[model samples]
Target: MKGFVTAGTLALAFVPGLASAAEPVCLTQAEATSLVAYALPQAINGTAKRCSAVLPAGAFLRQHGSELATRYAGQKDKYWPQAKPAFIKTLGADGGDAANLTRSLPDDSLRQLADVFVEGLVSQRIALKSCDKLDLAIDLLSPLPPENTAGLIALTMEVASTAEPQVGKIALCKG
Candidate 1:
C-alpha cells in the first residue's frame, strides 16, 4: 500500500510549520536514519527481536520521536511484546531465510523487507500480538493492497533501501 493520504490529510497532518496539532515528534532526516541503523545490531544478533520487542517505541524517536516522546515520556516503561513471534520468524543466519520464503524477490528487496519488517515492529504496541492485527498497519503502508502482492514485495525493497543504513546510523549516534 503506497501511502494514501489525500492533499487534505497531508495538510491536516502538517498544521502550520508543525506536523499538525501533533507537533513533529520530529526527527531530522539524519536522526531518523540513525535510529534505523542502531536496530540492525538486534536483527543481526537475534536479540533485536527480543530487544526491540521490549524496547520502547519512543526509542526509535527519529521516525516518530515526538509522538512517542509525548506518548511515553515519564512512563515507567513503554514496552511492546506481542511482536515476539514475528521477530523470531524474521531471523536467519545470513538474513536471507525470510526473503527466501517469498518467491522471486531480489536480494536488495529482501534486505529492505528485512529492515521494514524490523521497523514494522510497531505491533509491539498492541497486546493482541497476533500476526493478523500486526499486518493491518503494514498493509496500510503498502499502498498497493493485496492485489499487489508484487507491491508488497516491492515495499520491502523500498523500505530496505531507504531505511536500513540511514536510520541505523542515526540510532547509534543517539545511543
Candidate 2:
C-alpha cells in the first residue's frame, strides 16, 4: 500500500488544522474498535438518509459486511480514491450514477436528499473530531505507534456490519 493512509489519516484530511496541534498516538485494537463503533454508525445513518436510494445503509451493511470488509481489506490503498468521488457525487457535486439518480428524484426526495447531504457532512465533521479525541486519548493509554492502517480499515468495516440490527431498529430507510 504505497499511499495507503490509516483511519486516522482519513480523520486528519477532514480536520487538517488539528493535525499540527496534536501528535499521533498509538491505538490498540480495543480503542480503535471503540472509536469506530461510536462513529461509523452515525456516519452510515447520515449517509443513508442522503444516499438511501443508491444503497439501503442498514441492510447493505448487515448483509454484506464481511464480504465488503474482505474486499476493502485487500484493497486498502484504494479506499480514498474510491471514497472521495462517491462522497462528492452523493453531495450532488460530481456527475455520475449518483448525480443521475439525484436528478431522477422527486422534488420532495431531492429536498430530503439535500438535507441528508448536509447532515452527512456534519456527521463526518463530528466523526473527525471524535478521531482527534481518540488520538489524544490513546497517548494516555499507550506509548506505542498506532496499529496498521489496513487492519484498522478492515476492523471498522467488520464492526460497522454488526450495527445492522441496531440500525434496523432506528434506520432512516426501511429497506
Taken over the whole model, the C-alpha lDDT of each candidate is: 0.28, 0.35
Model 2, span 1-175: residue lDDT tens? 2122233333332222223323322333443333332233233344333333433344443344334334423332333333333333324344678767766777556544433443356345434323333333222222222233323543433333235332111101111
Among all candidates shown, the one with the greatest lDDT: 2
Give the per-residue Cα lDDT of candidate 2 at 30: 42
The clash tally of candidate 1 reads 23
Alpha-carbon runs more than 4 Å astray in model 2? 1-81, 88-98, 101-133, 137-147, 164-175
- lDDT tens per residue, model 1, 4-74: 22211211111111111122223333322232232322222222232345445533322333333233222
lDDT score, candidate 1, position 147: 21
TM-score of each: 0.20, 0.24
